[model samples]
Target: MVIRYSFDSLQPRPIDLPTEVPLDDEADLSVLDEAKILAAPASRADVERWRDQIERWREEARSRLCYSGAQYDRIESQWAQTCFAVAQVWLWDELLYSFEDHVFTPQKFLADARQRLGGLDAVVLWHAYPVIGLDDRNQWDYYRQIPGLKELIAQFHAAGVRVGVDYNPWDTQTRRGKADVEELAALVADLGADAVFLDTLKTAEPELVEALERAKPGIVLEGESRVLLARIEDHGASWAQFFADSPVPGVLKSHFFERRHMLHHVRRWHRDHSEEIQSAWVNGVGLMMWEVVFGVWVGWNKRDRSTAARMLTLQRSLSHFLLEGQFTPLVECADNADDKLVFGSSWKRGTDTLYALVNRSEIPITLKPIREETGIVQLDLMTGAVAQHLAITIPARGIAAVMTSQGEINPDMIELASEVSAIELSDDARFEHRRVHRVHESSRSKNTGESGVLIEPGEYVLTVRYRGRETGMYDGAPYVDEWKPLVPRLHDPRTLERVTTLDNPVIVAQHEVTNDEFLHFVRESGYQPAVSNRFLLHVKDGVNGRGHEPVCFVSLEDARAYCEWVGGRLPTEDEWQIAGDKQGFQRLEPHVWNWTESEYSDGRSRFAILKGGSDAQYDESEWYFDAGVRPPDFSAKLLLMGLGMSRSERIGFRVAFDRRNK
Candidate 1:
């Protein structure tokens, strides 16, 4: 299917685009207010001091091993499937949150409770396990027996927020009540607790998950540490750190791409500086711990809300791809950040690819558009809106998930030659570890071979005949057939693997205008301080745009002056695109994205167009390569157009000499 985007004329023009689609703070889903939700179990042995543990074999049922083929030719597709459960959790400590000063204010506590549970749209609300009393003084044996506790649990349940009590199976002796497997199970069953944060997690054993399920069928059991043992029965998810937004900002890059099911709860995400929260999403982690529990829970402002809303918006859109697709790293920039630039990763489904690009630095970072891709878009995660492709700049500490829309190249479409060689198909299906079921058609050929899906082990190969194209004369003209090869996909699944890392945004400056050139412009026109690049000092590499290489950090004005001194002018956006395309002299496209004379809008501002794309990391769309290719609507020049103004690595003018001068 051809996916086309209809541009909205309402958006800012000549785009310097970064928009935040609004989101509803309160959820329509209400919590269960019925008293039955708070069932006080008789006795529970689990305690805070010592925790119990269990181990188990892997659970096969939790995973769906994909397969494709007919009865005779069954093929097992690659199961890179992940279940991205980026759950927003509200971890609350009842005692600490209940009292204000030395005195107890049940009203204040209740208000806080209402705000955390009703206001926040969290899938799970965590109630710390032990109900240790006010002073070390009041050690409440059970939470259900406490005053008004029943209402809280019921409210949480009514809101569809699963209550997760902290479970410490190891420390059974401290509690005077029955605290064994059965006791803990009964407690979770009664309190409507859907999950237990296993303190001091060892492994996600089947025994632990099974026992929990016995009491509460759909309850989730999270471990303190991230578990790699996908072996546990129902241990599909976990919580990583207390703070989702890392304290030492820029250090904690969330591995949501690799570990999709884990939730890195941002314990310290407060209102004042919410860049961390915004950065967390860009880093690919979902928003968490925005609650009224341990902290003051200051709400976000306009800017922060814009970004936070954007993050949540993306969560709702790409949740599936993150959860289901195998994580093939998109050659994003290295994790190392030196206060300036950063990048992201990508994933694929069939011929289509999607990328997650983010800028974790304080400075804006630009990138070149990736090659062999089309329909590039700077996706708005909030509303799934595709912003202008030309204005693709990841805001400082921000993210943009872009994808490629290309047609798929299938194998059957190609006609192969005869001469069955080393690439032979073993009639006997070896390695019976997996099963396959091809549900499509099976074509046969006499000389070359049969055309159909091959089901086998250890990376199945499609052995087809290949013959060079032959030209023939038809009634009116010469006819030639072009031979295409079966796009060599991965060994198992028919998924495409990208090895060449997505190119970084390009950099260009024709050996920044030399210091001599700058002096010449200054001498003739008296370099006006107000008009000159104020951020000139940023070009520490060169004081007066001297040297053999391009000048670094030259403001737009300086660039223009140096160009005019050299008797040249900045190329228009169209001209720049032509040059980038190599117009009549198309050489390998340069990584240096040169500047254009086009205004971001037709305004007086300096928001000019910058071309060739930034050589930075960028997202690839899953639809980048679809089947059924088409002729270009216009030409390649139209595809290479883009926009950018300030904060480039280096700024140098690309002179478009007049025809007479040329």
Candidate 2:
């Protein structure tokens, strides 16, 4: 549909959004500490000067046998330390999932990503390296020149996901391996990766991280390094390196009894440190993600999947609060309801606060109100339910959420600003929009504050009329809904609900809720937003800052919270179709797989049907649905199923007012 937008499309309108208080002198996009660029070896001239020494170091590493107790020399220059620091800050944004991803052959991983790992943000490639210990320049060259490796990294980058290659930098594996600063630079230079994950390192000398980043500015450094090491300014992430049973609780939750405390020597002090690990997660600390269904899926059951999902979901949902908010330990490990062990922590960013309570046991647990001085509403992330008191109940082996607001909420009393739209998807839909800031091949091209839009993505009011027309294939061109003699239930709802909203068209919000708008609801309603993977991509300072992108991790209930706050509600599935199916309404913007007030079941699991697809950037149709014999297509009748309570980066909602609700 061709729809043009111009200055005269709508009258002047603006919504006053909350302004951010400076965290430091850093205003917009000035969050990075540029003064400490890590001098000397970080510069190309100095690094090139060490080429001969680096080559000899490589030769020595290649001859070392597995368990030879031989150590390969790495660059110890201060410049190298600067690279490590630079890497840690740049890579902190990634949420790692380490598995021997079988689909990651150099040729196919990127192409199959949309189908197998659509929402995946970080990917680690393992299983291809045959040599465990150090080999010389020839072996290193052969490994670095693996065909199609460059293309895979480039594609992943284009999709906004970083790819990391796994290697044990020291001696400890079935066979010992060796790597140094020069070798690290050579590997990254040829592979085109964003990071290198050095396995089993208690401390990844800052020099190595710095050298890698010097070669690739955005290079991330990660591994099963200690928690404190990951916390360094340039250390990207770590794998549960918190001392095992040493005093401080472990943050990396082991998958089973056999594998505890990452490196075999450090036995974990106790089991089920999920609560403690979560504390680290909120602090923007990275964990080794092996107790997951990442690859092979060996010996995995539903319980294992749910357990991993719970941690990932909590991480994804609370990501904004965890990464950006300052972490405050609210409660230490304690015995709670029915003998279940519980712990609590609060991630506070400005007036917005998300309090997380985790229960580790085989039974349910409950917590009474802690801060009863003022009213607070706890929004359960697992169940899309809300309660007024601070008290909350968590499922067995599960986590729960409760957020406190610093503002008042009066949904029924909402007085919205003008320029709203009430239209179905059409060729001529009107809406307000803004493009997110993009880095043009220059890492220093922009500042952190610039990522947070100064202006809000406003609302546009457009009208949508229903069309109850029947469709069929003509000249081999398949229409939205084709009537088949044998299949009677095809294309039924459009004609059914067309008359429902015909009498009085409702006012609809034009754009998907931006991060800034959702924060308003979170701050005012005391509701928690969905912890989404996408938030990690745009969080400026551990908080959601890419305000121009559509808000994700919102549930139907969360959607209702915003609608109620704005004196509106979600559009019905029929109304949504009518808006998109409209003939001549100029479109305000492309779709992002929105949630409608409609649902269905596939004879087993119940799912909320989502409509519309991502913008052209995604290159996939949103209007796709199939049941049994029906095939995937661009049909408006296509319906996609999503777990009602779970969150998705691609799925969200738009607000609308119903005449009937009045």
Candidate 1, 1-662: lDDT as tens digits:
85443332222122112111112234221111101011111112211111111000001212232211121111110110121222333222222222112122334433443332222333343332211210011112334433344566676556544455665444432334543565667777776665676655734456656777778655656665344333322443445433222222221211421243344433232333244454444334444443322112223334443445444444445555555544433233322322234444555655545566666565566654333336433332322334334234565655555544444322211111111111221222121111112112112111211221111112222221111111000011011111111112101112122122211112122222443555456668766543232334434443543344443445455556555655555544444433343323221221233445543311101124344432322112111111111111111111111111132342334444432111
Query: How well does candidate 2 score on lDDT at residue 380?
Result: 45
User: Largest lDDT belongs to which candidate?
Assistant: 2
Off by over 4 Å in 1: 1-140, 147-151, 169-175, 200-207, 228-233, 242-260, 267-285, 290-306, 332-340, 350-352, 368-389, 406-662
TM-scores, each model vs. reference: 0.39, 0.38
Error of 2 at 449 (Å): 77
Regions of candidate 2 where Cα sits further than 4 Å from its true position: 1-119, 127-142, 170-179, 205-207, 227-231, 241-286, 291-300, 310-314, 332-340, 407-662
lDDT of 2 at 218: 55
**Local accuracy by lDDT, each model:** 0.35, 0.38
Q: In candidate 1, residue 113 scores what lDDT? A: 36
RMSD per candidate (Å) reads 32.4, 27.8
| Per-prediction backbone clash count | 77, 51
lDDT of 1: 0.35
